[model samples]
Target chain A: MAKRDTPMLDELLKGPYPSFVKELYKVQERKPMVQDLLGQLEDSYEERIGHWKHGGIVGVMGYGGGVIGRYSDLQEKYPAVAHFHTMRINQPAAWFYTSDALRTLADIWEKHGSGLTNMHGSTGDIVLLGCKTDDLEPCFADLTAAGFDLGGSGSCMRTPSCCLGKARCEWACYDTMKLCYEFTQEFQDELHRPAFPYKFKFKFSGCPNDCVASIARADMSLIGTWKDEIQVDQAAVADYAKGGMDIVSDVVMNCPSKCIKYNGNGIEIDDHECVHCMHCINAMPKALAPGKERGATILLGSKAPIMEGALLSSVLVPFIDLNDEDEIEDLKELIGNIWDFWDEHGRNRERVGELIQRVGMATFLDGIGLDPEPEMVSAPRDNPYIFFQDEEEEEDDE
Target chain B: MGTPSIPEIAEEMFQMVSESMGKKNLKAGDLTKAIRQKYPEVDRKTCKLALRELMDNGRCVYAYFGGSYIQLPHKEGAAND
Candidate 1:
């Protein structure tokens, strides 16, 4: 009696694309290794046994913090069809994996673990899930041997993730990748040790567009910004208008600050009033451009799924000059100071965002020696839809 | 789409809702506001239904023993014991 396998298959076939079960089918036949594993997995399912289990303290020798593997004590009763967990490979200052790397990763997963992967886990590691506990040791050996390692988890500072800022995006105001890499290296000890009150995540984006959703995700968020001018191409704006673009209604009239104006001639921007919200730049991609004097604005206190819902990581440092190495060191020191404070006072599973919220943002600023500014609040709600005092003046006459 | 089995948190939550004497019992709207703050991921209506379950389970006592504005009763002798 070929045990009950089709029910599980049927259940898997019922919903959604990018299904791991469907992906498993791609290698089910061609790969002898996978076929063998699937056969064993089917047996466990027939007995209604669990395929995944847990294990003990395992890391590479000499490296206090390499791969951490887990195994199930009940492997005899519940045979695992696959290994599950994550790996934290060292990312380049701005990781740009070659096609070969992608292929190698896929091949390795097909051989030793589940073929499924999250492009990059929230922890900033190339997360490979579903590897067995026993396979963890060998997998770690192979990975580290091939030059990879585990990311921080369990009270340690997790891997710092960042956007490919200036490397690819024109909106990049600063070198985000460098800061992310430098922070990871600088805080390696903190990354490996689980001594803090809760987890901390740092994410950097090249621009305010926040490709990484850092504002809503990371404990510390770095977004690129400028205190300089907005470069407007008059020729481009004129061309857009010529191309049947309504500059008045679309660009000038819709300017959040009424910062841009068109009077039958060309366009003008009142630079002081521009909030650098990226709306105009996004609206007229060709006409407007970001300024050259690039710097990063640092924010803290963003987390999801706990306490007061999703809080937008608010800006702390409006601008930090990223032009020099010394500046980077200064930023690292500041980060270190914050971690030390949080580690000492944070409760278990409490993220830095939660701690900051509890301790009050004012205390956090005092600890870091940062002065509070009005911009520390959410960027001024710029939508002109609401009738303000000035608008009421106009309404009175009407 | 399949109708989700109302979350257990729904009934589990009414135990926490404080009922003022003169106020209307927990309406779907008020329950939604309270539970949404703590457990925003779950459906508000489901949470209300969970409150209903708690009422059925005898774990929670409601206003007038029937209306909304429910409260989880202290376990017998457990508080002092």
Candidate 2:
């Protein structure tokens, strides 16, 4: 086939500002619609203003989720991609894609919408960039046939996601992939419907290193950790020391808690003071390893902040065994309780963090039937200062 | 008119955004600032609601450049019929 002539983008080839556009075509597979899409990019430019405007409600049937509605400025000028509906396809755990699956997705997208994709969007879904209202059904059907379903797009739960835990990492304290898949499967209703005040996102990280940055991204975040002492290889430590390793400077001194010490030949770590950070293990892989007592810490209220400022998720449930059976059941129960409380009380567009700020932490804990823990509060109230505030005034605010 | 209704206030804000952001796309802050300056009586929440309304109707799109900029819907289509 001759090089797909991207007439729409031809002009950008020579212009001073065309370097980015020219660079896109550098890839061999960057042809056809990707080329065409990029070509039409300048059509939306300030100079080449599109004329169409958004007006009516456009969506697919039966499903109240997945589709994000938007439109073109001038339908006649860019008729090929005038109507651009973004679809969020629920991704596999860690976005694992078989060659066949990717081929299937690309085939479906090519037939129904622009083959352009956002790869994996920040929400951890395979974001199909552009679609028409007419093709949504066919596209959706084909994707579902390929064993792919649409992810949460409306005010319900966003797709549950996790880092590549046991699938490809040694520091994983639990099967993050399995848990993410389970959460996606189990919480279909939350993922498909706009039940809560706003969207909820669940993300998991294998360890406190937080490869996926779950602490800053997810509303409900889980980071794997251990509660016991880090297993030590005394012989390995001695070898490293013997090999002229700076055990005192690197391992002992760098221990955040000052719990590690070198006694000339080997290293010793105070188990009680260990915060379960993977720092020591990372520094000396052969000499140290994660402890045996593995579990996960659940954090809450992380978001980028539209209503309130950006907030990192705070530890809610400090340690929960992430093993199978009892762990899943307990997790489900806790999740349910949390959702129920939020559904009943959360205001429109009020994220969990904002809700907690609006209603006191005491109320949230009481509503969820959870006892107050030291990790629950955003900041410590250790000032030993007490102020009497009338309950009546506070009630009016919530 | 004695204080415009929410929808009316929203429409006014949208018009201002369209006028202010002629060819150049705009951040919510810039548009919000322009709207507030023009319609000082209109509150922030009302302004946001209007922008959201435009977004839902497909009239507005977020150009993901520097933080999210709301531009007149240029690409992407949906059935908001």
Candidate 3:
């Protein structure tokens, strides 16, 4: 195939930051489809409109998701990218990968796809950019043979991802990677099938630091936290003081809850008021650590701007012992209850957060068999109006 | 009656969707609920599997009009050509 002119896209190659367009150009000789991709993208840029059309059904047999069908309106002009379907392969726990695994994936993609990829998509899947419908089955077969499977797409549970918690970070309160892997394994059917009212995502962050941005992204966000006091090393604190680290401005004053104070020689944290925000811990990593009674705080209904608007997840269960098997099972049961309620009540394309907004939080909690909790709200309502059901009226009706 | 097989459920789903085309926008959850109501023994997972079979066999397709709906192929907004 001859290289199509892409002057507009070529302009991207001259920037200070390394350009993906430049990378595509580098691989154009071996994989000619990338050149066509660039050409089509440049055409779209020139036209100020997207050339891709959605709503094509494409996937492996018995699976309802994982392959997103794409077709270009400019099919005749750019035949190479006419059917540029994308595949989302589930990434390994915490995105850990061997070079061999990566090479194998690349080899398969090169054989069956446009040799373009997003190392990881926004939902933490290995996004194989472009392929024809004919190649999808064989590509999936090859991937599954190599012990890799497709991630979720459509209105299903998206591939659950986590931060490298106990594996790398000191502040990690729980085994985030383990929980992520467990959820992925447990909900394999959900990942491969489109059954929900809208897409559901699970994200595990080791601590309130939320390295994975679970609070703003996931439908179910599990952030690590502790019920006990913050652990402190006074010797390390004195060392930080000796090194001229400003404990007052950096740690004490910066605490969102104002629970920490610099005591001239060391620092003291007010455990009850700490709020488990991880600010002080982050500031003095060597001197401070998370308490021993570690678990996770479950939050719910976060999403991008779709129906109601962008929303961060609200607190659901303020703290849960994820390490306990029974508690984990309880958590899974809670997830099922949540899905059942949403599937029955939610409209098409409406996210869980929007559904919660539509049906008052109280109703939602009741529907899911959970009692209202103080932690679920940031503050008590200031409004004088309170809708209440009288017990006498309820007894009479019954 | 015994629990409906996957193929049986798929056929039933195709009929329901084909009948509802242009009249009702039936989503996956709707089909699952309908199937469960009809069979009573068939679980949600089996219903999902049946829907997958229908789509895979080209008997039914997804139509995205604001949200995803199941419909016959070649229908308006159907995801199959």
Best by DockQ: 3
Can you tell me the DockQ of model 1? 0.01
Arranged by lDDT with the best first, the candidates are 3, 2, 1
Interface RMSD of each: 22.7, 10.9, 3.7
Residue runs of model 1 more than 4 Å from their true location after superposition = A1-4, A8-18, A29-78, A90-95, A378-398, B1-81
DockQ values of all predictions: 0.01, 0.05, 0.38
Model 1 scores a TM of 0.69
Superposed by TM-score, candidate 2 places the C-alpha of residue A177 at a distance from the truth, in angstroms, of 1.5
lDDT of 1 by residue, A1-398 (tens): 11224456546657865555565666555544344445555655777785443322333332223343433333443344333344555555556888887777677766667665667665567777566545666776666666556676544566788888878888998888877877877776556533345567888888888888888888888888888788888888888888998888877777777888897667888889987778888888898888878888888888888635777676677688886788777887787678656745565466777777788777776676666665675433423221234456689989
lDDT by residue for model 3 (B6-70), tens: 99999998888888876897889999989888888888778878888887787776654444567
Give the number of the best model, judged by TM-score: 3
Model 3, stretches more than 4 Å misplaced?
A: A378-398, B1-8, B21-25, B36-46, B49-68, B71-81
lDDT of each: 0.62, 0.72, 0.83
- Model 2: how far is A189 from its true place, Å? 1.1
* Tens digits of per-residue lDDT for model 2, A1-398: 11445555656676766454555566325334444445456555635775434333334443335777656654454455566778889999998888989998988987887666888898889998777778888888888888999987655788999999999988899999999998888988567544456678999899888898888889999999888888999998888888888888887777777888888867788888776667789888898888889989898888996767997876778789989679779888988888767856776567887787788767887788777665554622222111223455687788
lDDT by residue (B1-81, candidate 1, tens digit) is 233355546543544454432354433334545666566676633654565565456554432111112344442221111
